[model samples]
Target: MTEEPRLSAQDMIDRLSPVLSLRTRIRAVAALLAGVTGAVFMGTLWWTEPGPLPGRTHLAFALLTVFCLAWAAYGGWLLTRRIPLFATDQVIAAWIGLVASLATTAVVTVVAVQRGAGVGLPSAAGGVFVAVALALVVRAQARRAALLRRKHELTGREER
Candidate 1:
């Protein structure tokens, strides 16, 4: 019996297929773009006086901006490192959905709190829950699409 040599991480990277690398780099570009967009918007919105925006509104935007930029950086970093064994594209998409929803919820909750509505926080939480649930659904669909694509590539036949 012959024994095979173990491959190092660098060796694996060196052997990575051009197609996979291209795909990953595309995702990375998307993440970087999102980060840049968030930064631009945040800068434009907060650069000058808020113009009657309450304190809570400022906090909400700041939190949302932070989340947006952070996730974008994380996604780009993962793609650059080719670490998608766990953080797959579908997972990234879901995270994007969840993050956007959470930001929206933050704004809504702030408005609700400012209005003195005792039920606002719970309602905002419920909205976030729904958004996450929808993202999960999207993730499942994405997984299915990827599987179908792989199957097509392997069999040279498209599944109806």
Candidate 2:
């Protein structure tokens, strides 16, 4: 009788945890939802009661968007190159990204306020709220990655 070959770590992961795959279908869907929601919010702001943004606002948003995209890409690369190593690195990266996002938001908010916008104490508080929410999301992603790794390990799969 012929025996079936054991699956490699990557193959096992692909079959057993499709959801944890890099830029998985679910993640793509989530990204789409987030992008659409953000677009709608920006559209609403642009169409109704559009406040004058500071000249630096566009540059700041662009830079932040780039930073976030780069971070996501790097995470994807890490997952592909070394799936076993991804969880720990991803957790650290997520925290760093959260901090960077918060700093960017705070600096831009302050700039906007200084540009004679009606932004005040409440706006600053809103920045804090946004930062907190971002941190929560990052932490959630990191936890998910860790859980997936643990699940894989518990299944007796050989680490690649």
- What are the lDDT scores of the predictions, listed in order? 0.68, 0.59
**Per-residue CA lDDT of candidate 1, range 1-160, in tens?**
9999999998887778443467667776777788778877886777675468777767766876786687678667656573324235556566666766766665676576767886556575868676775868587667867877887788898764
Candidate 2 clashing pairs, residues 3+ apart or interchain: none
What TM-score, computed on C-alpha atoms, does each candidate reach?
0.56, 0.42
What is the Cα-based lDDT of residue 85 in candidate 2?
48
RMSD of 2: 7.5
Model 1 lDDT at residue 107 = 69
lDDT of 1 at 28: 69
lDDT agreement of model 2 with the native: 0.59
- Output the lDDT of residue 23, model 2: 53
